[model samples]
Target: MKKLIVICLFLAGWHSLLAGSPRNIMLILGSADPAVLQDRMDVALRLYTKQHFDKIIVSGGCAAHGSSICEASFMKEVLLKSGVSSSMIYKEENSKTTVQNYVFSRRLKEADGTLVMKPGDTVYVVSNHWHAISVAARLRKYDNLEAKFYIEGSIDPKPTDKLDYVSIFNGEPDNDKFVLKGTWLTPQAAWQEGDSTHYLTGSLVYVTDPQNMRFSVYERRKVFSGLEPYAAGRDLRFIDAGSSWYVWNGEKLLHVEKQERKVRSILSLTDLIPGLSPAWKYSLKAGAIYGDRLLLFSDSTLLVGKRKGKIFEIEQETAASAYFRNWPYSWGRGNVSAARIDPQTRKLYLYRNQECLELNAGLKSVQAPQSLRLKWIDKSK
Candidate 1:
């Protein structure tokens, strides 16, 4: 009887793991020539008609030919024309790159955004066969053992097929274990401020204890005994490209803003951009805050804008394409992994694992690249 009870308990736990469909499933659109847009749209339309999901987020930027109609807007139109309600479709028109599409789509939000994905949320990424591997890999900072992924097309994938992206998406095995490489391999997703830097690796939080200058890694313990948690990525201010301090509530990402001795939840963009018009909602192509002004990259120009009253307004200053064009080369061939800035030194630090670099505030390399010994951590949590 004792052996039978133990066997029954094991079976119950195993069954729980296999049950329940993911809370969110997204159909990530692939960008190709205008001629192929309809072909890709057809597959997604079929999927929409077949399966039931919480939300449908379409991600894409400008359709080639430098048109104002982005890919997400185009897909939204297609879905609406096919009898799908406009209310059911969400548009993510900010992504100019593939990595942006995946990362931006998974982000959690409060209002007027695509979708807000909390920490515990399980996202099932759906993409085409050719693009699935890269999309799945860049979705998170860790090994992503907790998430499940699927490739969508007319036909299902076969195990024996020899496809580069497919094999990569399926995960590579070394001897008996799978080898997964990503942002966690390098110190990419982080923020730094003053004497201490705070980093979020996997679900573990690490920061300088301050009382003792050495770093302390929080392992499921309450990092802040009683302080309220702040949003990790949303209410973030970059001290450099890679590291900064954040408020933690011990569970999910928190959203809070700090000024002088007071901190508050970010109620609206007006709090930061005082002069921003209430009716105007701009698609942020690329931007950074400098002094009282904000540098916005859009339409090939860097526009300098400042807070005035109800809304923040911007005007064209100079050509802005240089920064966007050089992004891939300066960072690496892949996603912009980890970057940080030293407030006191006024220099930017870009972590590349191979050879890290320190750049000036103008985004120019200040010195030759230097190598640093990097350490890899376990991702089971």
Candidate 2:
């Protein structure tokens, strides 16, 4: 009789532990299209109502060519309209890819540094049927919780849907919007030092010193006080996106090098660096000029044009290819809004929204990104 009583007590304790309250979380991956996003919301809403999910996590950032607002913001808006309480919804607004969705969502923390989704919690991922497999795979890799998938069967994935490799910048869809809103101090300061009015052409600061019969090139607005000797009839125009200075005149492009105090003309941009497509000019997002190479960043590509003594060559890689795979969550969407290389230190600085990331000379991340705010002088005040 005593043995039977002990067995009953042990079974009761096991039942209590198994029935502990584990939060049910509904994670909705985002889409760029409003119609598609609404479809996803419908699925999430149905699951939430039926299963009584404790929370919903909306994940995605502003797409490279999508609408102005981020995907998470749009999803949250739809969820609110459907009468889901704001307190039950959490937004993961920094993710732009499927891999990032799982990575960022799992790392979200509460006010007291506790994980938003604890170990025993259950996660239900709601996405299109085509995307469900990848979502499930990521959930298995990133989270140890019990996960269920709710896929909307109506929407089908297309071959043309290359969103997996899409690169995005923070803020508005238009790339030029960030520069247009502010009076940049770099170009203005470069012009002041050049003693001539200048304007930005492509990424180079073009300062025309007509009085001295020469043109000056400031690598992305790093100011040089003096001017170089000009070839009188040939008007030196914008420099190519390479370490070796290649100037474009009306007739031809010429690569020029400096020996001590004298500048020597060498070759043209096309002559040295082969396979440079004409489309590169239109796709240019940002660039930073260094002593040994020039780093050019486009929406989907990074071009490293290296120069050694007199030889020049170009190497290309997709922005989302390698570096991004290693640090998916921290790098945001694999492309930057703006880039600059410090002349003295050779450190690379990438700007995205209100954050700045510093990379060492070997192109390795130095530390966590720092908060960056562009402060303009309030002349009106």
Q: Which has the greatest TM-score? A: 1
lDDT of 1 at 368: 54
- Give all candidates' CA lDDT scores: 0.46, 0.56
Error of 2 at 301 (Å): 30
Looking at candidate 1, what is the lDDT of residue 362?
A: 68
RMSD of 1: 13.0
Residue-level error in angstroms, candidate 2, position 175: 33
Model 2, span 1-381: residue lDDT tens: 999999999999999987566888888988767777778888888777788878888987765234555688788898899898999888876654555566557756554345677776888888764564555544554455777778766655577854332222222234233233322322211112325534342244555553635555545324321223233443244342323344443334545432221234545445645666655534444555556665655444677778755544776555533643233344433445456545457676665434556778777777766654233322210
Please give the range of 10 consecutive residues that has the lowest summed lDDT in model 1: 237-246
Segments in model 1 whose C-alpha atoms lie over 4 Å from true places? 1-38, 45-56, 59-158, 161-198, 201-203, 206-216, 219-272, 276-339, 349-359, 363-376, 379-381
Candidate 1 lDDT (Cα, whole model)?
A: 0.46
**True lDDT of residue 37, candidate 1:** 55
Q: What is the lDDT of candidate 2?
A: 0.56
